[model samples]
Target: MKWLEGFQKLSSVLFILTFQGANCQLAVFPIGPALVNALAGSNVTLAVSFRGAPDPVLTWFKGNLPVGTWTLNSSSPPDIADGSRDVLRIENNGSLTFKGVPKHFSGNYTVELTKSGLGQALVTFTLKIFESIQNVTLSTQPDFAQEGAERFTLQYTMLQGVVEQEIWYFNGGKLKNSTRYLIKGRSLVILEPTRTDKGSYSVLLMNPFSSVTTHRNVTVLYGPDEPIVEALPAQPFYKVGDSLVFSCQAEGFPKPTAEWVFMGQILSDFHQGVLNLTNVQTSQGGVYTCSVLNGLTEEKREKNVTLNVYGM
Candidate 1:
């Protein structure tokens, strides 16, 4: 009688195991951290899956409140527990989807699965919805700064959620925190900005979910450093039919204009900084002056070149 009783107990345990094994196994795909990131006004889906029982009731809860539910084998649409039926839906594969998600939809979500004669299972996820970065603007306090004299600042602003990172760029290259550059939360300060500091400045703001970028041009006023003159042919003395080409150049913002002066007269036609003399004669020889002027800086500089022409 005792052996028969033991056999009966074992038989009962086996029956329970067999029945549980036949139940549906609920699971979430790519199962690492159950976190979902989505941008506001975007369509997003939170996927889930199950095996075994073909007909199972799935109930989705946002936080503690029920949001939606559906029967896997039912042809009808998912029943919405809340008034968000138009924005939320349950797919045939038991996944929850959101159409044009709003910021208010960010919260914890849980899905429970159950069958008529099977065990129940539930999974949870943390959904984070963020507003897309937009309306970004970049500007500078002073439209233009003076080289070696003024501190320049570039600032940026955007309308969006919290930004996780702010990056600065100068001339398409990444900028780092240094003595010359001061990077604030939303601004960049250039200490004693130089001519080299002038270019396109950009700011990139980003978070774990979204990113945006904006840029602005910066101007720095500096030179007419010093006028420079270069004469093409080898110089010692030029005779009869010598073609002489002189190039005048200077470094300045707004591009300094050059005026070539032979002896004491201004060469009007050589305003482009190039002086071309064809068939140079003995009389066309003296100290030539190249005057460079920066209209913006109002600074002028002069360089002289001596050309000695001998009689043929």
Candidate 2:
């Protein structure tokens, strides 16, 4: 009876050792990238390698939900026929591939591998799908602005996934936030824009997958300012035989037109904002007026000057 009890214990130990050896025979390891970054409207593959006799059963799951199944049969090759969705495919090496990946496809995936004599092995992966920006557009709130305007807003819009970063540029140089410039969400505001603000502006929109840019040209319009009239000698007194030249200029957009006026008569001989006199006389010492006109703004400005000629 003692010998029989000992033999029974030995048999149980042998059986346990055989079971552990069979379980250790099957080995599985992930072969490809653990994180898959796929672009929208593209294809991606998640792969794995297995070593054991008699092909193992491969099952793919996404967030605890079964997505696909593959069973290797000796008679025929394994295919994606058992996939739950048409976009999913199971390759011969027990890899899962997705075609035409979309934004919603980004998530965690798990591959459950099982063999007849081995414990199940699980391989995990993280998938990220990114969409590129498209149909980008840039515009200003008021297309046209006058000098000393309160403010103006530039709006940017695009069609794409979430934007990770946004950069603004003016005339090929990066723009920084200043007291007069404010950057808001998808908009740029300029306080009291003047003629100096006229230039080409661009915005760069970027995501993890790709980046896009848009450009716009802005022009700030102003009116004709006070005209400046000056004499060639820069002094009010000149000799009778001395030549005198009077010039008029103003600061304005669209270039202000100037007309010279003496007393109540317009000087037709001096048309281009300049009046030249060969011989100065006491009779021409009266007040001379320079009138500037801005046709676009329909605004007029003028300046007056007095010249005194002395006999030599």
**For residues 168-225, what per-residue lDDT tens digits would candidate 2 score against the true structure?**
8889988778987888899888889989889999999887788888999988878688
What TM-score do all the candidates reach, one by one?
Answer: 0.49, 0.56
Error of 2 at 135 (Å): 5.7
Q: Write candidate 1's Cα lDDT for 1-312 as tens digits.
A: 999999999999999999988663654442446898888889988888776677689899998899998888698878996569778988888888899998899999998888766668788989888876778998887888778765888888776675768889998899988988899878999998998887888988887776888889888998888877888886777887888888999888989999989878998766479998889888888899999988977888999998888876
The 0-to-1 C-alpha lDDT of every candidate, in the order given, reads 0.84, 0.81
Model 1 local distance difference test score: 0.84
lDDT score at residue 240, model 1, on the 0-100 scale: 73
TM-score of 2: 0.56
Question: For model 1, what is the error of residue 304's alpha carbon versus the real structure, in angstroms, after optimal superposition?
Answer: 0.5
lDDT of 1 at 22: 63
